[model samples]
Target: MNLFTDIRTLVIASLDAMVADGALPDGLDFANVAVEPPRDAAHGDMATNAAMVLAKPAKQKPRDIAEKLAEKLAMDDRITSAEVAGPGFLNLRLAPGIWQDVIGSVLAAGTDFGRSDVGQGKKVNVEYVSANPTGPLHVGHTRGAVFGDALASLLDFAGFNVTREYYINDGGAQVDVLARSVYLRYLEAHGQEVAFEDGTYPGDYLIAVGEDLKTRVGDAYVGQPESVWLEKIRDYATEAMMDLIRADLASLGVVMDKFYSEKSLYGTGRIEAALDSLESKGLIYEGVLEPPKGKKPEDWEPREQTLFKSTEHGDDVDRPVKKSDGAWTYFAPDIAYHYDKVTRGYDLLIDIFGADHGGYVKRMKAAVSALSDGTVPLDIKLTQLVKLFKNGEPFKMSKRAGTFVTLRDVVDQVGPDVTRFVMLTRKNDAPLDFDFDKVLEQSKDNPVFYVQYANARVCSALRKATEVGLDVSDAATAAADLSLITDPAQLSVAKKLAEWPRLIEIAARTNEPHRVAFYLYELASDLHGLYHLGKDNADLRFIDEGNSAATQAKMALARAVSVVISAGLGILGVTPVEEMR
Candidate 1:
C-alpha cells in the first residue's frame, strides 16, 4: 500500500537483475539506497540514489550504472520512465495508475491507512509531565504533557506497546512546603487569620483543600506542634494536589496508564536494592569528588561520600548517591526509579522533561544504562518554554496559580483542540510563542485552523454528494473506477497521500510527534489547493453534474484525504472537525 516502498522494492529487484547480467558487480549493500520525491517537481516524480551509492562499491562509473539500472527498471509496468540526472541520480516518472491506486488504498484502509509495524510491538515506557504534586500544572508542564501524550499515541500507531506514565515527586522537601501552606489555609477555614510566609504557597486554589481538611478532622491538630500534623498533612495535601493535576490533564484529553509514587521507593528497600544491583557491578564506590571547575581550592570543600561511577556509562563525572550526612541525595531516588523500570522488562524508556532539566538528562541516561547493563535504551526529550501573548502583549500570570498560568487557563480560553494542536506547532526543544489572537484566526497562517478547515471541506463535499444521490459509502468509494482521476491537480493530492505511511515510520523512529503536525499541514495545503482549482474547471470539481461514475471517482479522492487527516489528528490527540465554526 506504500507506493514509495513498492517502488523501492522494484528498484532493488532491478539492481539485482543488473548484477546477474554482469552490468554491475555483486555484494553491493543496498542499505543506503533510497527512493524519495525529487527535489524539483520539474525533474521527475521520484528520485533514487541507488546508482550513485553502488557505483564506487562496484568499481563502475555512476552514470554507467545508472544507465544499466534505468534499462532494467523500464521493463516494469509501474515506472513510466527513468532518466539519469547529474552524476548518478535516477529520476523516475511513475505511471498515472500508480497514483490512483494510492487513493483507493487510503479509502480501503480508512483511519488505519498509515498505521505501521515499524516498532514491532516492543514495550515502551514514556514518562512525562512528572511535575511536583504541589499545585495545578503550569504552561511549561502543558507542553510536556501534550508532547508526551502525542508521542505515546504515535508509538501506538507505529505498533509499539506503549505505557503512559507519571512519576509523582511526593517524597521531597517540596511536599512539606505544600503541607504547611495547606495548614495555614486550614487555620483560616477555622476562623483564624493567617499569613502566608514567603516559603509557603499562596495560591487561592489551596483554599478549598484547607476547608476540606477542617471538615475531615474538625481542627484536631489545632495549636499542635509541627511533629503532630506535618506528616499527616503532607500525605493529605499530596493526594488533593494530585487530584487537581488529574483534572487538569483530563481537560486536555490526557490519561496516564500509571502514576508512580516516589514515596514508595523509600521504606520499601527498593532504593537499597537498586544500589545493590549497581554495587554488584563494581559501579558503586566510596570516594571524594574533585572540586567543581572554576572554584578556588580554598573555597571548595572535599567530603568523602558514596558515589556512582556514572562517567563509566557516559556521564560527565561520577555522581554522589549519598551525602556527607549519611542521607540519600536527590539523584538517588531517580536512579532507583529507572532501575525499577528496567527490571519491569521494558525494551525502551522515554522521559519528557522541561527544558530546565537539560542537565539531568545525561545522569539519568547513565543510571538506566548501568542498571540495565546497556540492554534498555533511554531517550530524554526536553520541552522548551512557551511564551503566551494576548492583545499584542505578553499574557499576564493567572491569579489562581499565583505565579504562572495554569493548563486549565489556556484550555479554557481556546478549548482543548486548539490548545493541543498549537502546543505542537513547534519542535520540543525550540521555544514556542502561543499567540491567542493569531491561533484563533481562521486563516492559512494558523495550522490548526488550516488543517481543520480541510477536513471540514471534505465533509461538505460528502454531504453535497449525498444530496445529489451519489453513493459515497466507504465500500462504494473504494471500489469506484479510479481511472478517471487522471487530472494533474487530483494526482498531486494522491501523491501527497502516498507519503503518509513513510511519514509515520520516520516520525516514530525519531520520537518526534511534531513532525506529524507538520505533515498534516502540508497535506491540508495540497487538499485545499486542489479544492480551489475546481472553481474554474468543471472537470476538476469533486462532483461532476449528471455523471455518477465521474462524481464518485472525484469524491473518492476527497474522502481519502479526510481519512489520512483523521488518522494524523488522532495521533495528535485532536478531534477532527466535521464543520468549522
Candidate 2:
C-alpha cells in the first residue's frame, strides 16, 4: 500500500471536516496539499503542506490552520503525532503498528510489491536508438539503449501500455555510401583489388556481408557497374547492418516491439496523407526558405519549394518539406512518421534521441501538435555522451582497427546487469563516465554490486533460517505474525519498504528512470545497514534459536526487503542475484 497517498487522503478528509465545522471556509482550494517524506528524517516520518497552501486562500495564517488540522489528524489511529513546524508545515509520525504491517504487506506482494496503477493503462509509444545503419552501435548509443529500455520498463510497471520502437533510417545519402562500400567489398569477394573510398565505410564488420552475398549468388554480377548491382546490394547490406544492430541491442537486453523503416514511407501514401492533414489546416505552403542565419551555404539562392508553416506552432521559421529538385527532404519523412503514429491512436509519444538532435526536438513536437490538433503529446528525451574511462584516462575507440567498444564489449566484460545499472547511474542529459576498473569492484562504491549484495544477503538470511528449522518460505512469511517486529532498526526498513509504491508513481510521472536507480541504491543501503546491525545484536538476527514466533517475524522483514529489491531490479531489467560471487 502507498502510505504517502493514504496519508494525503486523510489530510484531505480532515480539511473537508474543517470546512464542515466552519473551522475553515467552504470552497477553499486544497489542490496543492501534498503528503511526502520530510526533508529531514529526524523531523518525522511524513510531512504535509496542506496548512501552508490553504492559509492564504482561507484568509487565515498558516499556523492557525496547522493547529486545527493537527488536532483533527491526531484522531486517526495511524497517525500518532502531527506537530507544526516552521510556517505551519505539519510533520507526522506514524503509529508503530502501521510500519509493522508494511513488512507483512511486502511479503504478501512479493516481487509485485511496488507495482503502481498510476498510468491507468494509457498507450505510450517509446521510440529510441534509431542509430544509422552505417555501422555497429558504439558506446554512445549504448547509453540511450539502456536508458530507453529501462524507461519503457518503468512505465510498464506503473501501468502504461508501452511499445518499444526503432526507426531504421534507410532513406538517406548514408545508405548510398553504405551501398558503395558494400560494392567495393563485393568486388573484393570476387578477388578484385579495391580500395574503400574516403566517404565509404571501412569497418571490417561488413566484410562478412560481402562474403555472404557471394555465397548467395555465386559470381552473378562480379564485374557489373553500379546500375545493375547498386539497388540489390543496398537492400542486402541494410538488412545485414540491421541484423548486427539487433544483435547489439540483444546483448544489452533491449528488444524492440517494432522496427519502422524510412524506405517504406517513400512508396506509401503516408507522406502525402500527413502533409494533406497539415494542408487542410493551412500549415502547408509553397515558399522559399531563407538560408540559416549566421551560416549560409554556397548554393544560397532563393528557390521555390514546398514548405510547412512550422513557425505558427513554435518553430523559429517555416521548414522546407521538399527540396528544389522535388524530392522529399529529411524533415518530410519525420513528419510523416509522427503522423502515422498519431493515426495509430497512441495517447502519447516519447522519442529518445542523442543530445546532438536537440535542435530537432521543437520541430518534431510541432509536427505532432499540428497533426493531432494538440490531442497527442510528444516527449523527447535526449541522452548525452558517455565517456569511457580506464585508470583515469579517456578510452579510445576505432572501428577500423577492430578495437571499438560495441554494446557486446561492455556487456561481455561486466554482463548485462552491470552494464544496464551503471549506464543509468546518472541523468540522461548529463555526461556519464563508465569506468571499466571501478564498476566491477565489490564495494559500496560500486552501486550495482552493492544493490546485488543486498539481495544476496536476504537470500543468505533465508538459507540460514531454513537451516535452523525456521519456516521462512513465501507462504510462511506471508502468514507470519509481524507484530513481533518492533525494533527501531527493523521498523526503519519497513518504513523504506512502504515508500516503494510511491516511488514508482513519481518516477513514472517524471519519466526519470534514474530515480529508480537512486531508490534502489537507498533501499539497498538500508537493507545492508540492518543486516550489519544483526552482527552485534543477537535479537536483531533473522533466526532465533529457540523461538519460532520471533524467527518468523524477522524472516518476514528480510523477505520483504528482497521483495522490494526484486521489484526495483525488474523495472531496471536486471535480475536480482541469489548469491554474490
Window of ten residues with lowest summed lDDT in model 1: 291-300
Please give, for residues 209-233, the per-residue lDDT of candidate 2 as tens digits: 8888889988887878889888888
**Pairs clashing within candidate 1:** none
lDDT of 1 at 214: 97
N/CA/C clash count, model 2: 0
TM-scores for the candidates = 0.98, 0.97
lDDT string for model 1 (228-315, tens) is 9999999999999999999999999999999999999998999999999999999999999998778568866889999999999999
Q: Which candidate is the best by TM-score?
A: 1
The superposed Cα distance between candidate 2 and the true structure at residue 344, in angstroms, equals: 0.5
Q: Positional deviation of 366 in candidate 2, in angstroms? A: 0.6
Give me the displacement of residue 412 in model 2, in angstroms.
1.7
Regions of candidate 2 where Cα sits further than 4 Å from its true position: 295-299, 398-404
Model 1: per-residue Cα lDDT at residue 385: 98
Q: What are the root-mean-square deviations of the candidates from the true structure over C-alphas?
A: 1.3, 1.6
Candidate 2 accuracy as TM-score: 0.97
* lDDT of candidate model 1 versus the reference: 0.94
- Candidate 2 collision pairs: none
